[model samples]
Target: MAFEVFKKSSAPVSTVPSVTIQKRGLISLNRAAYELIGSPEAVELLWDSDRRVVGLRATDLANPDAYPARPQSAQSNRGPILVAGSLFTRYIGLDTTEAKRWVPQVEDGILTLDLKVEGQPVSSNRRGTGESARETK
Candidate 1:
């Protein structure tokens, strides 16, 4: 009888774009999502109450409605993109009791998340010790 050796995989991480709305209202974007928008430093949030959709449009930092879209930390260049959205969520009356993840669609340079579409619930245990949504600058 011949025994086979166990091997570890070195496959690359998933590049499928996704966005998460944290329990505290922070918006987290996966690497693919970040790159989909050309990696902007700021974004303007647009809400469509009628359609129950949230949109993210890249904009200059000087824009009054611009929100900072920065990497999780300086140490990891490939880390998730974080955006503080506590106020925006509250304004839109979105329930943030649990984190939710959804696939985004881009149209005319705007990334949109349709709340009407069911979102995957994110386990709290998987969340990192990053900035909270309440800490928006």
Candidate 2:
């Protein structure tokens, strides 16, 4: 009585080492506050030593789905974690150059990112080169 739909791909999945954000100094300190927080205004900023990431607790200006909007009875809930600096370096191996590219711009009260993908195309076909798989050097 029920059915599920699925899509398949033969192309090899590729990922970028890192993305560069153009025109905004390397990694703005308030990047997370504007982007993830959904607004430049914040109620409080806490350094969560446990997660090694800053926690940005939202006030009334936060998004409707923000963690703070959850019922107070949900004692097990935690706010969002803002990753940066060594925290990103340790976890995502974010280098200085990469870290510097992580910036967010605020326009008309909305946060946005301007980035471009830079990488080589990956072929999905498994067939050995045009010559032959057993070709000798």
Whose TM-score is greatest here?
A: 1
* lDDT by residue (tens digit), candidate 1, 32-87: 99878889999999999999999999999999999999998889888789999999
- Taking the candidates one at a time, how many backbone clashes does each contain? 0, 0
Best by lDDT: 1
Every model: Cα RMSD to truth: 8.8, 17.5
- List candidate 1 segments past 4 Å from native: 1-13, 125-137
Cα-based TM-score, every candidate: 0.80, 0.22
Q: In candidate 1, which residue pairs get closer than 3 Å at backbone N, Cα or C atoms, i.e. clash?
A: none
Misplaced by over 4 Å in model 2 are 1-33, 60-137
lDDT of 2 at 90: 39
TM-score of 1: 0.80
Tell me the tens digit of each residue's lDDT in model 2 across 1-137.
75433212222122211212212212222323333544333323234344333333445635543322222133532222222224323343323432222233333443333323222222222465685323421
